[model samples]
Target: MTALERIAEWVTSNPPVTAARRAAATDAFVDTLACMVAGASDVSTLGAIAVASHADPRESAMCVDGAMRAPSSAALINGTAAHALDLDDNFIGAATHASAVLVPALLAAARQAGADGAALLDSYLVGLQVQREIGREIAAKHYTAGWHATSTIGQIGGAAAVAHLLGLDATRIVAAMSVAVSTASGLKWQFGTPVKPVHAGFAARSSVEAALFAQAGVAGRSDVLEGERGFAALYGAPHADWPTAPIDTSVAHAIEQPGLFPKLYPCCGSTHLAIDAVLDLLREHSFAAADVAEIVVTVLRPNAANLPYTHPENPTQARFSMQYALISALESGTVSMADFEPATVRERRTHPLLDRISVRTWSEKAERIMLDQGRTPHRVELTLTNGRKLDRQREVARGAVSEPFAPWEKRRKFTSLSGLSDAHYDAALRLAASPNIDAIERLLAAAIRLRNGAGE
Candidate 1:
């Protein structure tokens, strides 16, 4: 059988949903919801809302703003909003914004199907596992080749999740995945633009439509993933060994293993490690930003490539700029959302300190050695005016599984970003045991109302 078929079978076969897995899924939902709230007013989300609001058959799915849209359109708008700020969690195993796509797609499907919170969490774990399985084959090459894994890999896995939620059989699950494979597309060139988050919206919409189409008897090739002209061949992995082993979700789920990297800073995750490294140095030493002669950051080639902007002209580009991210952290002792505002970016762009930061990459041989050893390290070297050099290297950022945030830390982030109360955070925590997601939807609507009232 093809790899896609094997995945479909595993997806259709109900795996045991452990307590730990459910908690992880719930945590992901909370984070994605907070992101959706924070980014609701972003220009990218507005664009998605405009499109989704105009689609036919509206009122099928609830948006963050309490407005209703068609199911696919809701998925698009919600997904875009979830990722617009670039603060959503990252699953390194898949090299994608896993929850940003999964949560929006699953939420819409769950609401439409009247699925309870347990079902949503179950489907979330299932979809994340599928993404990990597929990402194992092509993530490194695909991401390096400049294809946005969040869209390409996300759609296939998201389709599986939506199919599971809608109670599709193995055969129809295969059909959904095949349809998703054909529609999945995104590029790294859109990194500094609003279209980057739209990639998540597009993936979410495709996942919904593909699964719904499969349920409606749309036929598709079952071998689309490993076929000669298929996903692996066309999207960076030419000769990838598809399906090396059966997916076993009986043990640890992907969310509990390599785990999701939740962002503390609202910028591209590529700059996160470097930011953490520099912060570590600053905390340990007595040097101020003005005391530094130069800042040198070293990361993997792909990360280096992701940060192409040295002097960002706007907030969007600032999110992808190593110079801006690092320097802002240095200047203010930490990077905050306020730093990325248009006026702040414009003011900081002319700072002489921006030119003092230089970014480099590890040699190809060193990168190969690190890759072979399963290490992704970002190093920061600070040269002071008195010739004192402080160096720090970070393999894991603050919010990664290796160094996770405490419960209070996570709650603090949620409240700070969404401008909601502790009751809302507790509501999200209780979702796993709730009868349905209706309460969560109401909380989200309240967040939208709050934000609108605050004129944010």
Candidate 2:
């Protein structure tokens, strides 16, 4: 069978995921919801809502404005909101923002189909696994080729999730996957722009539409992902390594290996390791931001390429600027969402630090080591005016699988973003464990109300 067929079978097999994996999926869902709430007020999100509303007058629940929109429109708006601040969870291997795409698509399909929570979780897990596998097959070549995996790979994954939620058979799921491949599109060049989050929005909405169309008997080539002139050959390297066999999720799921990296700061994941390394140094010594004469950060070549901005003039650019992220963390002892605001990025105090900070590219050998270890490697050096220097290298950023966030930290993030009462917070956690998605929908609706300042 073709690779696409094998993937379809795997997705439809309903492989058993461990309770730990399920819990991790739940955490990812909750974290993405928090990010959605935090970014609800962003202009990019508002613009997306406006666009989606115009295209489709039908209404569903939008997490941002508490306005009902069409199911696909809701997916577009919610997905855009989830990624507006670049704070969504990322899968390192795929180099894709998995939850940002999957959650919006799956939530839209589930609500439309009246799917329960367990089904939602299952479909999400399956979609994440598919995305990782596809990402692994394409390797870094696809991303390095300037294709944004969050939209390209994520479209197929979103289709799988929606197909699973709708209980499509293997053949129909294959059709959905095939149809999704044609809809996949995004460019890395759009990074640092509102178009970046719009990529996630397009991926989510298009994938849902693809699945729904397929389910309605729209025919598509089942081998669209692996045939000649297919997804890999067209979007990735012509000679890229495609998976030869079907993956067994029952043996090991993607959520349990090379897992999701939840962001503690609202910036690009590429800058996270450097921020952590700098914060660690600050904790070890007694020196103010002014004490440092120079800060040098060395990161993998891919990371260096991702962070092209040294002196950012806006929040969008600041999120991708290694210099900005590192210096802000040092100056404030923490890089909160507020640090990425225009006022903070343009503050006079940050200009001096931005001048002192330099980001360098790591050696090719270090990049190889990072690929082998599945880590985001970064080396930090702070040179004090007194001529003393402190240096440290971090292989993994905090909040990665190796160093997961504590329950309290997750709760704090949720409460801070949603501004909901403790009762609502507890209800969200309960929804995670419950089999009822109606409860989940209600919880999200309440969050939307709070975000829009309607229920206060």
Candidate 3:
């Protein structure tokens, strides 16, 4: 059977769900909802909602603001909002912002099908697994070549999840995934722009549409992912090597393994490691931002490429700017959500510390060796005005599996970003045990109003 067929079969077979997987899924949902609330007013999300409001306005699925639109339109608006701040979690296995796409798309499908919270979590795991499986074959090559995996891989995997929620059979599941391939598209070069978040919107909308089409009896080539002139052949290396046998998931699921990476900082993930490294140095030594004469950061080539802005003119570009991120961390000892505000960017842009920062990338050969050895830390070098240099390297960010945020920290982030009452947060945490998705939708709607009223 083709890999896609295997995925469809496994999803339909009702694979076992572990307690750990359920917890992870629940956390992801809460985090994504918080991000959605925090980003609801972003220009990109507003733009998507404006377009969606005019498209169908069928009032079929719930949006962040409590209004209803067609399922696909809601997915587009919600997904855009979820990812607009670049604070959404990451799945290293798939090299995608898994939750940003999956949560919005699945929420829409779940409401349409009246699926319960358990079913929604199950569908999320299924979709993330599909992305990990496909990514094993092509993510590195695809991402390094400038494709946005969040949109490309996300559309395909999210379609399978939506299909599952819609109760499509394996045959129809294959059709949904195949149709998704045609819509899978996003470029990494669009990073640092409003278009970047819209990519998630596009993927979420396409996934919902693909699944709906399949449910309507539309079909496509079953081998569209691996056939001649297909997804892999067209999107990856011509001779990209795929596994001879499917990896075993019976004993361990992807979420319990490589896991989803939650972000502690609200900036492009590529900048996190460097920021962590700088923060480490500050903890060990006593020096204000003004005392720093020079700050140099060394990272992988792809990460450096992702951070092209040395002097960002706006908040969007600041998210992708290593110089801006490091300076913010150095000066304030933390990179808060407020750090990315327009006035903050404008004020910080002229700081002399911005000029003190410079970035360098490891050579391809060096990076390859580090990858093979299984450790590729981002390095930060700090030169003080007194001519003393402090060096630090961080292999993992604070919010990664190896170094997780405390429970209080997680709660703090959710409340701070979502601006919702603790009662809403409690409701979100109990989602796995809830009978339906009604509470979640209501909480998200309240979060939107509260966050907006606070002028965030």
Candidate 4:
């Protein structure tokens, strides 16, 4: 029995308490929905994704704005839109966008399946737990070896959601898990490319296909996870060791740990500490980008490595560039959606400030490999020419698995993300406190209608 086997049995039995998972699901749900709405107007990128997906479509579920399409296509668009701004939540342990990767896909499938909000919410919890467990089992090992954990571990989440929705028998669920092992994919090298968003879309599409295959009595290798030639052997070597026997997962870790970090910024969580650190410094002093001389950031490996191209030629690449992001923060006093525009990144003023920024490992905690990152966590030190130097450090970034979101913080985040008016905000509170998706949707629709009629 693999971890999937155990999870399948537990979820099959417990079916998960809706009330328990509801609040968390609703929190993430509201955030994902907000991102989708905000992103809907992003005609260039998000619009492209939605248009590309329009080529082939099916009506399995209705998306956030209430459009119906094929399960796979719906998931792809929703996943891409939810993550377009890079503001969705992340999972440190898994090294990926936790909610962004899972919620959109499940929401589409469940809504199309006519699943009540309770079932949809419960399935999402199951997906979150399963994906995180897979991530812990692999750790940074596979990711360091070059796999993107969000796509790699996230497919399992897709599988979990699909299984719960279909009521797959344990055996079939185990087989679907096997399909996921083979399908696990995503590359960090593609961070700045359109393929980055494709990672989320592919995971969502694969899960739907994987589940459909299993439902059709297609059998996959049950031992694919721990098998000698399986996922562990092929992709996750050097990190492949779980306590469960080849056929025993009865004592698998309980599936009820809290979910991952809900993000505030629209970039990698790796960038958060630095962003927050820079903001911290500004709290004390108001300095224009031109006023600042050199801003130095010393941090961990990819935290440093994840920084986008020094000169981001495009919006997608801007997400990966620390130089650009930090510069935008210094100039704008915040990093907003507007900062990523082509004109913004190309501005001569912003470029000079970005050029003034330099990052180095400062103190070599370890030798610099081609990417010389030390074993110890990276610490950031920003120095300004005004003879001002500010220091900030985090062993674990705030939204990392080490530090999770507080309930109130999540609500505040959700409310802000939902773009709900005062009345809608209060109404959403009621809906979130005891979720009824249909009722919530109706309330949301009525609010919009009211707002529109007011102009008349």
Candidate 5:
């Protein structure tokens, strides 16, 4: 069987997802919901919501405004909002924001199909496994080649999730995957623009449409993933390997392994390890930001390539700049969403720190070693005016699987970002664990009410 066929079969089958895996999936979902609520008012998200509101209207929930829209429109708006702040969960192996794409698409499709919460969570688990596996097969070359995996590889995963929600058999699921493969398109060059969040929106919308089209008897080539001119051949590296059979998830799902890396800061994941390293050093040594004469950060070559801006002109670009992330953490002792605001990014105090910071690419040997260990490594060094150099190296960031957020910590983060009361936060956690479609609607309604009253 072809790669797409195998993937479709796996997605349609019932994989044994452990309780721990289910809990992790719930955490990812809750995190994505918090991100959506927090980014609801962002310019990019608002603009996409406006556009989607004008499109065909169907009955589905809009996480931000609590409005009902068509499935595609709902996916478009919610997906865009989820990624607007760049705080959504990411899959390091896939080099993509998995929940940002999967949550919105699956939720929309589920609402349309009247699928229960259990089905939604199960589909998400299966789709996430497929996305990361495909990423492994393509290796890091797909990302290094300038393709935005969130939309490219994510499109396939989104389709799988939607297909499962729609109860499509293996044959129809293959058609959906084929349609997704044909529609996949995104570029990494758009990283610092409003269009970056829109990429997630497009992936969610396209996947929903692909699955719906296949359910309506639309057909596509089953071998679209591994064919001669297929996704791997044209979009991935020339030497990429295509797996003949799907990786078995019956014993353990991918969500239990490397899993999802939820963001602690509202910046690019590439800058996270360096930010953590700097914060670690700051906590160990007592020194003001002004006491540091110079700072240097070293990271894997791929991360360095992702963060190209030395001095960002705006908040959007700041999210992709290692200099901004590191210096902001140093000055404030923490990096929060407020630090990435336009006014904050333009602060004169930060300019001095930015001038003192420099980002360097790690050695080829170091990069290979880190990759082999399945790690994203970073090192931070500070040269004090007294000629003392303090340094720290981190193999992984805080929210990664190696050092995941505790239950209370994640709850605090959700409340902080969503601006919801503790009661609402608890309600969300309960709903995430039990997931009925009707309960989801009520949860969103309650959140909207709280947000309006809080004037957030």
Candidate 6:
């Protein structure tokens, strides 16, 4: 069977979850909804999508805080919005933004099919579990070698969610899985452009199309994932021993034991550890930007070893640039939405900071220590003119596996992004904790109120 077939069969056979599991899924779904509201009005590609989506509106699924749209359009908008802040949770090992990408796609499918909140939550959790497994397996090769794990692995998550919502039999789920193979795409090379969110938009739209096609009995190659020219071989170099492991296509539970980590920072997951380390130093020691002579950051060779970023020319690229972000944090005290703008792209203040900051391979002991904790740790050393030296070592970045952001912190982030007032933020946080998608819809409407003049 194709790799896709294996996952589909598993989704079909997975048993009902306990109440606790369902509640956990509900929690994650609400977080994604908050992510959508926070990002909906971002001067991101999502806002433009919101505009374009309204052009051919259909009553399939809800937009951030507005009228219904065609299922495909709704998925696109929500997917875009969820990823708008670039602040969504990451599938840590896989490096894909888990909740933003997966939750939005699932919401679009669930709303279109008129599935209840309970069913929607179940499907969301199942889809995440499947995505995690796929990411764990595939990214050992594909993502490490440079493909964007988001598009490559996101298709499976999107497909799994649709299969659950549509009540597709194992056979049809397999069909959707195979057909989705043709739709899987996205690359790491496009990180800094408007095209990044478009990647999520396309994943959402194509999954809906794939599910509909499968519903129509459209056939596809069975082993699309394992075939000679299939996903494994074509996307990136596969791990040499992955073919030898006899994967049992029979997992019944979708939620991993601990569930996924919601993010605290708004940059590439790989950079979170370093950002956290640096921020802590600034906050703890209160380092003044003017006092620093040189800043050296120790990062994993694997994350940016082959990454050839000469200088970031845009905000999207800036998100992935450890040099740019650290530099911005040094000069600006914090990295905000404005740091991603075109005006700051090549500005002297930002660029000079980049020169002061240099990245080198982390020591073997450091790498082993951080990885053991399921987070990347960074060691930063800054030399000051007054003969003062500051050293900061972080085992994990903030908003990640270690040093996570709290609920209130996330709400503040949403309030800033969506321009929601304190009252609206409180309500949205409640929506995040609730199971009602309508409450989420209400939160979104309030978000739109904040979007009027906040042009991306």
What are the C-alpha RMSDs, in order, of all predicted structures?
A: 1.5, 1.9, 1.9, 4.6, 1.9, 4.1
Candidate 1 wrongly placed segments (more than 4 Å): 454-456
lDDT: worst 10-residue window of model 2:
55-64
lDDT of 2 by residue, 1-456 (tens): 877788888887768877787788888888888788777878888888778766455554444666667778888888998999988898876889999999888877776777777777888998998888788878487887888899999988889889888888888888888888898899887888888998988988877888898899985887676668888888876776666676787667889888898988989988888888888988999788878899888877767778878888789988889888877887789888779767877783447777888888867786777676666678998999899999999888888888989999988888887676667666666654675566556667787766566884
Q: Which residue ranges in model 6 land beyond 4 Å of their true spot?
A: 16-20, 41-58, 65-67, 237-259, 305-311, 341-351, 362-375, 387-389, 421-436, 453-456
Error of 3 at 149 (Å): 0.6
Q: Cα miss at 312, model 6 (Å)?
A: 3.4
TM-score (all chains, Cα) for each model: 0.98, 0.95, 0.96, 0.82, 0.95, 0.84
Higher-scoring candidate on lDDT, 3 or 6: 3
Model 3 steric clash pairs: none
**What does candidate 4's lDDT look like per residue over 119-226, in tens digits?**
666677767767766676774567666777777788876787777776787788777777777788888888877767667767776777677777778867776766
Q: What is the model-wide C-alpha lDDT for candidate 3?
A: 0.87
How does each model score on lDDT? 0.89, 0.81, 0.87, 0.65, 0.82, 0.67
Ranking by lDDT: 1, 3, 5, 2, 6, 4
For each predicted model, how many residue pairs clash, with residues at least 3 apart or on different chains? 0, 5, 0, 13, 2, 5
**Deviating ranges (above 4 Å) for candidate 4:** 15-21, 41-58, 64-66, 111-113, 245-259, 285-288, 348-350, 360-378, 396-456
**On residues 140-186, what C-alpha lDDT tens digit does candidate 5 reach at each position?**
87887889999999988888889888999999988988898888899
Q: What lDDT does candidate 3 reach at residue 34?
A: 91
Judge candidate 4 against the unseen true structure and give its global Cα lDDT, from 0 to 1: 0.65
Q: What lDDT is reached at residue 184 by model 1?
A: 86
Q: lDDT tens string, model 3, 72-123?
A: 9999999999999999998878889999999999988886788998889989
Residue 95, candidate 5: how far off, in angstroms? 0.8
